[model samples]
Target: MMIKAIQLLVAVFGVLNLNGIECRKSRILNSFEYTAINCRVHSASIVDFGGVGDGKTDNTKAFQKAVNHLRQYASDGGAQLFVPAGKWLTGSFNLTSHFTLYLQRDALLLASQDVKTWPVVSPLPSYGHGRDAAGGRYISLIFGTNLTDVVITGANGTIDGQGVLWWQQFHKKKLKYTRPYLIEIMHSDKIQISNLTFVNSPSWNVHPVYSSNIIIQGITILAPVTSPNTDGINPDSCTNTRIEDTYIVSGDDCIAVKSGWDEYGIRYGMPTKHLIIRKLTCTSPYSAAIALGSEMSGGIQDVRAQDITAIHTESGVRIKTAIGRGGYVKNVYVKGMNLHTMKWVFWITGNYGSHADTHYDPKALPEIEGINFRDVVAENVTMAGRMQGISGDTFTGICISNVTIGMAKKGKKYPWGCEDVKGISSGVVPRPCNLLVDQGEGIVGMCDIPADSSAIDAMELKKCSYIG
Candidate 1:
């Protein structure tokens, strides 16, 4: 009887085990049934389609073969094109949706230096703001279009733009080489770029324009200090961006948030919105740790920057706009920034010299509204200038709060008083009320009163730490 009972128990357990195995297999099959296939390549041993992997690399056909293979075998959907560990020298590569470029540890995708070798695609005319030192039209290096769910990820790797040749040209002229950016994502959505190093870009290192839900994190960009227009990251007319834990030591603005230019702005009709820049460090920068304008004619809104740490940067925080550039900057907040040295620790300058001798008339330009700065601790500043709440045709609804700064005096004595407040045309008057200085010895010097009584609400200074 005991033997019979044991046999029955074994049969029951066997049935349960069979059911579990069947369930597991069904799940695996379901996962495989609904997933996109991937195209994988080991970069180290890849000989171009010409079958020449002699290490003296001509990556043109090799990379084309990989891309073509992915295109052909891309399943019913798209595939992830994989690049394994090795150095791959290639020309310009285009990207598409349902595709990913994954680099493994110790991978190097080096850009070919020969300009003619790069295939040309007539992109929209760039947002032409100022001439670069390179003296040519701006071009982007890695250009993509209308792609979705694209990602560039790896453990250890680099994307070298070979911009030293381009930087040399920048020294001669300024507005040259309307060529390539290190990485350009255009008219794409859901793009993610992380965990890589971008070195020496011809133009802005990572340029993402006309995109949505973009993310860039855990990356390092190293560009020459004199490399003109080598902006670390320029997110133009993008939305829902989260850039975090990225290190940028560039010659120009570390992260410039801009829309298109005058006509370009209208055509794009897309503002850079819902941006969160956190845990970012700027070692060397020409402008603010995070800046706006110079091309903000398209308008920007719903942006927040926090937990920023900067060293040896020029401007701690800056927002600039010229006269002719008509746009609105609103719903912005900045906090938890630690800046060491800056020319203007906190600068909000309008009248951006759009036209020479046109003069800075605040009454004529569009208003910059809803700007807030709080919980910022800054030190080693030579000049702490505040150009806030200057009324032009469009200046209203701006505020600065909870700023603690340590001023570093330069050879030129710091200005004792504030700049003119009379809408630019009223000459220059020091207005008080909206301008608030919590900790600093700076004083608001001589000023003229505006004919409009409401203009007095434009400036304020409170909780002075420095007795200037």
Candidate 2:
């Protein structure tokens, strides 16, 4: 009888162990299934479709043909187009859904400098006219619309926009329409752009507008300090996006988050929400390391950024908007930021850029609330903070905690400037402007604001596997 009891006990324990193994297997299987659903198995090479990367050959037709040929595989298992090492000159080209454009290490994709190569497309309906002028705009060099599961990635390949000509035209007032961006993904979902180097973009470097589920990582963008409007990685009207591990030396804001421009944005009514930005290093002597608005009217909410380092940047965190912008910027939380030689560590301006048109109502007032900055350290800062808000619509719920800033020897005469804002300050060095109420002593240095859990959960992204 004792022997029989021992056997039964062994059998029961064996069943429990099997149950544990099954649970672990289920988790592993779920992870693998998720990756398989997003993975692309089809592959092809650009050279197969008569692509010549000799720096002089216009590969526009070749690229179009290759993409067209790969459309057949989209329904099967998606396709990847591999670009070998060489300088490839091409104009604007459209990307299909479930497509991947992968560049080899030594490859340089050069945008054609000829004006005729770029076609003029209609301005965004949100912005009644082109941003620079009053007509259609030039299409982006690498443009996509209504595409899903599209990725522009490589082993740190380069895309040279050769934008000196466009910059000269803009400076000379010789352009008829707004300049084109280097990469613009519009109305798309499940987009990934990673491991690429962008140089000399005509306008913004990477713009993901009206899109969702975007992941931009391990990108290096470089532009001249004097270049115009070369903002890096603008996520406009996008949701559930993650931008991380990016290094930018930009002419404008290193990372500008926007919804739309003034009245047009108000009518379009799409908000940029649930964005996660981390591990970004930037140098923008002429602009902010990260800026919001000045064109935000549709609304911006639930933005969380951390682990940022800014060197020689004009402003660390800037919020720009005017009275005509009728949107709300709320629940922005930033932490773990380090800045050196910045004009202002924190800046919020009520009167900044002009509205897109006269249709914007002057009295439409923007709402700025729940802006939190914590665990920030700055050295050689010209000014600690400059907070400005509209008179009647004073920016409310602004919180600054655990911030320490060391002023430069020749820093601004006033370390802190405040106009019409209301908030609380805790454990901030150099004190703060009188505008912010001191929220006791022990409450300082503690971050009670919960992070956006949804954005954090989306960070479990898998890297693309290349078969070429």
Candidate 3:
């Protein structure tokens, strides 16, 4: 029955019959030519404060040696710096253009905890800023800057952050230590990261910031869901990106696509576009499996997500923008999804706010438009769904077809089968909004709204099966 359903859905949608098999074929290879790949690194492990090996635990020599080699080799083309297996402890190593850090499945890159050994960069407002004024800890376990044609791939081993100390400090003050992410990419292009176990991050796990043409595939990320600000894959101000065949169990959004600040978008003056997310599975300390912007001040559009599976997540598909996020999200295609367990099945809210309540600006909020959902199946949805549509202009050009929702639970008794949504979350319980129910047989339309709304323009449910 499941196979028959899938075939019927594919026939109805006319898209992606391959089921994401093509992605596995295109793993990052050394053949692609990009300037960032030509870096050379020091042969020995670095252990120094300022290039002086202090014996105690200084990786400065090793890190600086790799950086200097990169300055020479990266310009010619990229090259892989072989870090043989075993514990290669380091403070912080800067990433150069066109370089690959290939680990041999059994390798472990452990990080040092002593704060003084690490270096600091300029302050950014979005993350844990103003808390680490005397910045000493590394911001990323593996970091890259202004790079291209970079690949970090290996079948074995793990990059351990040893985050217990950092986690304790963050909980006590929430500002004293701003631990670096597990893997970070900033202002670079043509990046590919695959096949690594990124575990126990002090902060966000893998952050790709201000980059383009990026691919993050086939990684297993494990961070305690209770860990604060530990998002799995955060693509900030990026374009032409793809994330596939990965599994994430994190503290925050499994995959979040965002722009810049209220005016931060203007700071970079570039929006995120052309994103494709496929064959990914997620578990939570996570709020949403795949979310688009509370920080969409720079706008995010032309995104395609398919073949996603979520288990024990907060929400299945969420698009959250706020009054402060002034961008657009359109041309999205989400299909071939299998989701089980969660608070909400689908939620689209236009209200955005940071956890700290700082940096409040109204200019960031933009009208959300141009979204599509096709061939998605869900089981055991706790909360119905919330769609705000467009503020003054209705959420138009939106389509939900070939969706098979199993059940809606309401305690032990009086369980509602399925509910349709069409309403703005503004103060007055404005009548249930407009939701079209069309070509959907067996799919019942429950008109619980006592008042009237223009939200639902059509309702068609034909040749379908529903059980209440």
Candidate 3 residues lying further than 4 Å off, grouped into runs, are 1-60, 75-77, 125-138, 355-360, 389-394, 411-433, 436-468
Query: In lDDT terms, how accurate is model 3?
Result: 0.61
Give the per-residue Cα lDDT of candidate 2 at 23.
Answer: 11
Local accuracy of candidate 2 as per-residue lDDT tens digits, 188-290: 9888898899999998999999999889989999999789999999999999998999999989999999998888899999999998899999999999999
Question: Residue 405 in candidate 3 has what lDDT?
Answer: 58
- Candidate of highest lDDT: 2
- Tell me each candidate's TM-score: 0.74, 0.90, 0.74
Clashes of 3: 45
- Check candidate 2 and list the clashing pairs: none
List model 3 lDDT by residue over 111-216, tens digit each: 7787666566654434323223334445676777877667776654588777777788777875444677778888888777777888887777888878887778
Q: Top TM-score: which candidate number?
A: 2
Candidate 2, residue 128: how far the Cα is off, in Å? 1.7
Overall lDDT per candidate, in order of appearance: 0.60, 0.84, 0.61
Candidate 1, residue 293: lDDT: 71
